[model samples]
Target: MDRQTRSLLAHADHPIAAPLDDDSVGRLLTRAVVRDDARVLDLGCGSAAWLIRALGQRPGVTAAGVDVSAEALERARRAAEEAGVDGRLTLHRGEAAAFEAPHPFEAVLSVGATHAFGGLLPTLDAALRHLAPGGTVLVGDAYWEREPSRWARETLGEYEDLAGTVEKVTAEGWTPVYAHLSTRHELDDYEWNWTGSLSRWALDHPEHPDSAEALRAAARHRDEWLHGYRESFGFVCMALRRTTDT
Candidate 1:
C-alpha cells in the first residue's frame, strides 16, 4: 500500500490496532503477570494502545514499540503523550525481526502483525528471541475456524489449525499459559473499523492523488471479507512462556 493509504489506516481514531477489543487486551495483559517496573516490547505495536494500557496498569513500567509504518509510529507518539507515558516509551520504525534493544524484555507482544515475521511459527521464534528467560510472549494469530474450500484457503493464504498451532508452540519449547479467542463481534468490529477509517479518509481527501486508490482498496477489502473468508476464520491471543527446568 502507498503512504497515503497507510496513513489513513493509522488514523488516530482507528480504534485498537490489534485484532482485539479492550476486554481481550486486559486478558492478555493479565496473563503476562506483569510486575511493577517491568520492561516490555511490542512487535508491530501499531499506535501503542497495548503499551499505554500496560503503563497505566503497572506503574513505572517501560515499553518499546516497533512498526515499519511511520504513519503508525506518528500516531503512537501522540498516543503515548496523551497517556502521559511518552517518557517511558520508545518507538522504533522497522520490521519486527530487525528490532534491537539493550536487552531482552520481560514481556514481548505482537497482535495481528505476525505477517511481518513471515507467518505464525516464525513470529513465535522472533518474539521469543527477544524474550527474557521465563518471560512472556503474547501473540495474536488466526486459525481456520472450520475447513475451507481450496479457493478460500488460497485466498486467505496459509494458516494452521488450532491444534496444530498449539503443537507448534509446544514444539518450540514454549508452554501455553493463557489463551483468548476473539468473538465474532470483536472480529467484525476490527474489520469494519479498519475499512471504515479508510472510507472516511478517502471521503475527506477526495482531491488527493491517492484518494481514489484508497477508496477502491477499502471497498475491495470489505468485499473480500464479506464474501470470502469471514466465516471460515478466527483469531486468538495466546500467551506463552519459555519452558524451564524444574
Candidate 2:
C-alpha cells in the first residue's frame, strides 16, 4: 500500500499513532511542556495529535507542526478546530527536516518520526536547531528489547537495547529527564488496532478501489508483527534536555 493509505489505516483507531496509552501520552506531554506559555514544535507531526492534546490541556501553550502530508495536515487542522485550539496551532506542509521556523520553540517533539531524519541522533540534531536554550525534546522510537532475529533486524532496521538507546542520546548531549518503555499491552494494542482498523475499512468498503490492497496490506502487517518482531521489538518515549550548551 502507498504511504498515505498506510498512514490513514494505521491511525484510524489510534490518533497518537504509537504504542502509547492515553495516560502515558498525557504524562509525557506534562514532562515535556514544563515552561509557562510554552511554544512547542512537532517535527513530522503526522496528524498533529500530540499538539492538539497539549493545546487543549494547556491554554497558554501554542504549537506548530510540520509534516510532508497535506492530507495529514488537513486532518490536523480540522481536529484542532474541533478542539477549539486552531488559533493556537499552525500546520506546515513540508519535509520536517527542511522546515524552518522564525523563532525557536521551548519544547520540540518528534515522537515516532526519527525515520524522517534517517535516525534518532539526526532527529535530535534537527530538533536542536529549532529549540530554545534550556528547552526540552520529546522523542520516541523503537528499540530492541532483546537480540532480534535476522529477519526482524532486516525488517525494522537495527536498534540498540534500551540502555544503549539511552546512552546514545546522552552521548549526543541530551539527558533523559523522564522516560516510558511501552508495556506489552500497549504494544499488542497498537498492532491489533493497526491491523484491525485497516481490515475493517476494507470490509466496510469492499467496492472501493483500494479495498483489496488494503486488506492484503493489513494481513501482511499483522503477520509480520505476530511472527517477525513481536518478541524483540520495543518502543521508548523520553523527555530530554540538553546536557550542555549547543
Candidate 3:
C-alpha cells in the first residue's frame, strides 16, 4: 500500500479498511486449498480479522500478516491476542511486496490490496513467488461491470472485465478454482460502511488534526462511488492454485 492509503486509513476507526463484506471472507477461505498446519500470508491484511478467524478455524495453521499502517497493525495484534492466536500470528509493518517469510506459504491471500504490487499481474507475480507447490492464491478486486464512460474510466483507471481477469490468471499458470463475487446490494453496503464509519470517527475525534481529512475522505468515497462509479464496477474474490512447481 502507498503512503496515501496509509494516511487515509490512519485517521479512520474502521476495523477493516476495504468494503470486502465480512461474509465474503469465509467464502475466500473455503476456496483456498489448505493442508495440515498450513502457513498463510495475508498481504495488506488490515486489523488481521481474516488471519485470526483462519487460525481459529484451522487451529493447526500459522499465519503472517503484512500492512504498512501501524494503527492497523496494533489492532491486528490486539485481535490476535484476544483470539489467543498471537503466539502463532506474526504481523509485519512494511510494504506487502517486501514481506518475506522463513519459507513459502501454503496459502497467500491478498484481498482488495493489489495496488500494493502496483497492478493485477504484478500482484499475481509477487504472490506466486511466495507460494508453495499447489498453494492457493486468493485475490479480491473490483472490475468493470460494464463499459464505463470516458469520464468514469478516467476516474477509475484500468480494470479488466471478469472474463479477461480469469483468462490472465490462467495464462499466468494458475488454475482457476473458485470465485465469490459481491452483489450490488453487498457493494452498496460496503461503500456505505466506509462513509458511515469514517464520518462517525471524524465526529468523535474532533480535536484530532486529521479529523477533517477523515471527513473529506468519507465524502470523496461517497461522491465517487455514488455518482461517478456506481453500478459500473463489481468486486470478485477469485481463488487459484499453482499448477506447476514453484
C-alpha RMSD for every candidate: 2.0, 0.8, 2.5
Expressed as tens digits, the lDDT of each residue in 1-246 for candidate 1 is: 576345446344545665677878887897884778789999988777888889888877899999887877887799788988899999998888888777989899987878788888889888877888778988888898888667678977678888887898888788889998888998888888878888888899899887788888889888988888888888878888878721
Measured against the true structure, the TM-scores of the candidates, in listed sequence, are 0.93, 0.98, 0.91
- Show where candidate 1 strays beyond 4 Å: 1-4, 7-12
In candidate 1 the C-alpha lDDT for residue 184 amounts to 90
| Candidate 2 lDDT, 159-187, residue by residue in tens | 99999999999999999999999999999
On TM-score, the leading prediction is: 2
Model 1, CA-based lDDT: 0.81
* Tens digit per residue, CA lDDT, model 3, 1-246: 344453445335435454565677766786683665899999989787778878887889999999887877887888799889999999999999988777899999888888889887888888888888878988878788888767778877788888987888889888878888788877787677768877877788899887788888789878988888887888888888877866
Query: For model 3, what is the error of residue 157's alpha carbon versus the real structure, in angstroms, after optimal superposition?
Result: 1.9
